[model samples]
Target: MRTRGSTAPHLWRPYTQMKTAMPPLEVVRTHGARLVLADGRELVDGIASWWTAVHGYNHPHIARAVAAQVETMPHVMFGGLTHAPAERLARRLADLLPGDLDHVFFTDSGSVAVEVALKMAAQLWLNRGETGRSRVLAFRGGYHGDTMGAMSVCDPEDGMHRRFGGYLPSQVFCDLPRTRADIAALDAALDRHRRELAAVIVEPLVQGAGGMRMHPPEVLATIARLARRHGLPLILDEIFTGFGRTGTMFACAQADVVPDILCLSKALTGGTMALAATIATAEVFDGFWSDDPGAALMHGPTFMANPLACAAANASLDLFAGEPRLDQARAIAACLADGLEPLRALPGIADVRTLGAIGAVQFEAPPDLTVLKARFLERGVWVRPFGDIVYLTPALTIDRGDLDHLLDAVASVLREGVPPGA
Candidate 1:
């Protein structure tokens, strides 16, 4: 393996190109939706640090809970042994999740949670003696994560896994139901491959990383009905849409549809620590409930259900209940949407989409992100532009003043162009 210094600049970058020259801003500290840069600049966080940090950075409740758990027991292998925190968190999640998704399988991140869900779906088919139903189906412009199985279900046009062409598993993709034609195309595809389909995975209501495209709840309900009609399981990847991001506790709640299996992450631990869970119904769990060990769901990470993460999750649920975070998120989303209405009338704007606390403004052409990003930064607002689409996904705890500042920055950029050095 090459040394760290010898690696290419782009190899370890989180997202986008690192080799392409861009100005760097260092954040040294953060608290309650504000970030303090190492250069003594403070700015409001618009994207919530990649759409996590729901309760904002360094939340006292989360910090205290995590610290207490660490002091008691930092970690333990979850394969066989059990812990109180994990059990409590699982029970809380079961109570909060929409339907009978009672079982929880924890993993390190959203990517691994997706991998677990896909494996469970395939194994469920196998246990039901439907070996022919091995192929997985996902929608175009959907992004799950970066793991191999997750990559297989994601849209190849996303350009994340182009280099690993042969490494990915064979899967089917259907167009997102943006129009009648799109829905018809999906039904046709299902008719063509229903016998071979194992599951249909979707990022309900809104597609996050795929430029924040929003679709109606009716489209999701249609897909759920089709899945049931075809005897195929449905998996909802609500890692980004969960926890009040979609104006409801879960986007599926709004549609009155429930998936056989659901993937949750992102704000699961109140953005305090990395934690993800794949909750499934008893029927799905029954597939692995056999005396024969080989029939078991033989997949789990070493750090599954770590106590510290579990404690943080439990505390997060408490905060949600005490503060009514979902209601707060709804109000904030409406405010942001109203504030952004003027952008729709702007010259270069292509579309403005909003769902709950997430709003996006896509331009006809890719703006000079370098300049636009700098302008926002200079204005004490930290908003990220995904290519041509500038989006806001602030924490639920964001103050009204900070939210107004964020909107003002966008307004300034639209009117005067990017500021100097931006």
Candidate 2:
């Protein structure tokens, strides 16, 4: 979707093929689930800022909390200073999660959160004098983040980092769990390579950003058990599925599985500001509690616990506790499941799947991403498609009417076949 526009100041976009990417939309304002363009047009956000703003943009509750915290103190170096918001958020998260997952390490984003998880896992093994455990085991059809360490574990066939394959560390990939046979294979692989593996990373039930793939809860439970049995750290990258994006408060909770390390971000701040946390279990933390300074987990982001982000996160969590966010998510999921059901009969579409607030339509053949997206924009919806998948993950606050509009836009585009000149 190319567009001619008045030029603005310089900026670069991530994951964009700049040579052919569409002109960036200049969003001037946002409220609820809508984006207000510079031209005064409104486009309902179909993916919730890539699934971050679960409560929607410019949410009054989150905005007020962030404002209050900014006035108090925007940020302080977390190394020496302790703040209430961050502490509250950590404790709140620990209380929300199950098991011995009681420690929280703050970071600036999801990618860094994954990095911290990997680092913690490696350091934990090293602190125990087990230095051979450096490799991470991740499943195929998984994506944690874009950072080099995170990318190293993503599905190599996803082609997100094909060019950088040689530079990234080689990691083990287990087949995505589907059948009982697949579980047998996964167990065999883990058992065979137990000594070389340091951590087992997974995206839990839903693998966002890797074509928004999803699997059964049993798969995650199996991975968690296998990791524990192998004495390997299990890291659930819930950056996309945490905060009620996957029908549960955390996707792993649906399986009643507890991981040793959990990476959380995206919706942690209700999409207000960038903040992430790599939470750990007592065992992982205790591994670094020795008197040896070098055995410690030494990673920390400068804005580890930015007060504004923490305040927004607190308000978001408060909303989840006091409001009906989970109910809203379930409603959104039902809406998507019913709304996109018709698309399965479409000629180009091969399958349609819905989970929580996320709905994906996979094409039998790859659709022209740029042209399809242009048509969606023309229909006043902000739906982004990549490769052979077109997905909608609207804010939990989006009404049935707005969500229908978003779904209908995708259906209309599929019906019209991208138009004559789109």
In terms of lDDT, model 1 sits at 0.86
What are the lDDT figures for the candidates, one per model? Answer: 0.86, 0.87
lDDT of 2 at 97: 91
The C-alpha TM-scores of every prediction are 0.94, 0.96
lDDT of 1 at 168: 89
TM-score of 2: 0.96
Error of 2 at 389 (Å): 0.8
Least accurate 10 contiguous residues by lDDT in model 1: 1-10
